[model samples]
Target: MNEAIKSVKLADMPDYELVKSGTGGCAGCPSPMGLRIVGKALGPNSIMVMTPSCAVASIGVMPKSCYDVPVLNVCFASAGASAAGVSMSLDAQLKSGELTGEKPTVFTWVGDGGTYDIGFQGISAAAERNDDFIHFCYNNEAYSNTGVQRSGATPKYATTTTTPAGKSAQKKNVPLLMLEQRVAYVATASLAYPQDFYRKVMKAKSIKGFKYIELHAPCGPGWKFASSDTVTLGRLAVKSGAWLLWEGEHGKLTLNTPTKPLAEGKMPLTELEDYLKAQGRFSHVMKSPQKDAVIDEMKAEIRREMDFMLGREKL
Candidate 1:
C-alpha cells in the first residue's frame, strides 16, 4: 500500500561497496547477494549491462574482476539492446560535450534466461522506447547460468533441468509484464527485503524511463535449498504469499516492501507449508500423491497472486 512509501535505512545506503568481496557466486548464491546489494545501489556512477545469465556467470571473470563499476558484457538476446546502447551512448557523450561527469547509470543485469525468455524481445523493445536504462531482473528462477534449464521465470510445480517433473507453466509475472508496458518503473524485489531491497534500488535510481526491477534471487543450487536457506528462502517468499512486494509508478499501483504486511491481512500466510517444505525444487511437489492436491494448487495460486497484487493497489 504505497501511500508514498519510501523508507530505506541501512543507515540510508550508499557507502559504496560496488560488489567485490570474492564474488564468484554458488555457495548460497543469492546471485552474489543480489550483486552485492545491486552494486551498492548503483554507485561508482554505474554501467553493469550484463547477459548470458547469472549476471555474467557470477560477476566478472578474466583479469579477475568483481565489479567496482563498468561491467558491460551483453548478448543473451542483447540485454535490451545492450542497455539501449549504453543509455544512448551515454546520452550522446553528454550532449556532445564529450562525456563529462555524472549520468553514467545505464543498467541491465539479466537472467531468468535473460529476463523471462531470451531477453523478452530486447526488454520489449526497451519498453517501447522509453529506454533510458535500469532493467535489473536477477530472478533466480531457472536456466540458472545455463544448466538448471526450465526458465520463463520457472514456477508452477518447480523442478527443473528442463522441468524434470514440474514447471507446468505459471510463473511469468515479470512485474505484471512490466506493468503492461506503460513502464516508467515497475518493481517486485526480494533478496528477502534488505531494507526493501534498499528502497527499490534507491527508487530505481530516482527514475527516468523504462525502469524495471524484479529481484527475488534465491537459488541455492537451483532451489535444492539449504545453502543456509538463502536468506531463509527469501524470507519465506515474502512471508509466504509467494513473493509479491509491489510498485508500478507512472502506471499507478503501489504496495511495496513485504507487500504492506501482505496487503493488510497483517502477514497471516505463515510461510506456505514451511515454505514449500524447504525447496528441493518443491521436492517433487512434496512427494506427490497429489500432495494435498498439489499443496492446494499452490495455496490457490498464492491466493490468486495475492488477489492479483491487491487488485493493482487501487489505481
Candidate 2:
C-alpha cells in the first residue's frame, strides 16, 4: 500500500458512495456496510463478481443495480473461476493495447453457501492456483437466501430449517482453509469493524494474487435479531470470541486488536455463551436441559479450531 493509504484513518474514509440505497436486502441488514467499504476502497477501477446469493438482491435486479461499478453475476459455483477469468481477460486487454488504463480489480462477493459448500470447489481451485482476485464470503452461517437452510458454516447446535433440532457439525473455518491453500492474503472481518475491513481490502488490493476475507454477516431475519442492532451484535460476536478478527498476509497470521486479547487468554471463550443467547437461531440450544454443557462443548470446539491458527501466529 502507498504511504497515503497507510496514513488513512477512520475519519478519512471516502464520502463517495459506490453502493447506493434502496437495496432488496432484509431490513437492518449489515451486508451493505461491507459492500460499500469494498466499493470505496477499490474505487471506479474495479468489477464485482457474484453468485446467486442475498447480495444479488442487495445489488438489485439489474437495469437498476445498487453497485455503481460493473458486476458479473456468474453461476452458483463459479465465482472463483469467473473472477480469475475476468482478471486474466483484463490483463490480456491491457497487454494487447485494447485497454489503456490500469487493469481493473475483479472481486467475488459470495455468501457462506457459495463459499463453504456450493462453490467450494471453484474457490479451492482458485486458491490453489493463486488466482488474482479479492474474495469476500458473507457468512451468515446458513443458506439464508434460500430460506435459512443448514450450510456447512452453520455453527454446531444452531437451529435452522434443515436442522430444526440444531446443526450437528462445527463451522468450517474458510480463512484457515485459504491459508492452507497458501493464498496471498486472508482475513476474518465483521461489519462492526468497518475500518479494519477497509484496511484489509486496501492491503489486499495492493497485492496481486488470491486474497480472501470472511465477513461475519449477522443476518437480522436469519439470526433473529433486530436489524438496528446489527453492528452491536457483530461487535458482541467478536468480543465474545465467537468471531475473531485477524489478518493473514503472505501466509503469516496475526490476531488483530480485540481478538488478540481473547485468544491470548485475557478474556474467556465462555463469553460466547452470552453471544449465543443473543441469537434466535441458538434459542433451541439455550433452552435445552444442558445449556451450560452445550456452551462448554462449543467453547472447546472453537478453541480447538482457533488454536490451529493462533498457535501458528504465536510462532
TM-score of each: 0.34, 0.95
Count steric clashes of candidate 2: 0
lDDT tens digits by residue: candidate 2, 1-315:
233546256678887677787788887676677888888788888899999888886677648988887989999889999999999998889899999977898899999999999999999999888898999998988888889999999888888989989888777788888876778989898888888888888888988989999989898888888888788888888887788898877667788877887777776544787788777998988888998898888788768756765788865
Task: Show model 1 residue runs off by greater than 4 Å.
Answer: 1-48, 54-71, 74-85, 99-109, 113-131, 134-140, 149-156, 161-183, 187-207, 213-247, 254-287, 304-308
Best candidate per lDDT, number?
2
Tens digits of per-residue lDDT, candidate 1, 135-220, equal: 88888888877678887778888888777888888887878877877688888888877777777777778778788888888887
Looking at candidate 2, the ten consecutive residues that score lowest on lDDT are 1-10
What local lDDT does model 2 show for residue 282? Answer: 89
The Cα RMSD of model 1 versus the native structure comes to 16.1
Off by over 4 Å in 2: 1-7, 267-270
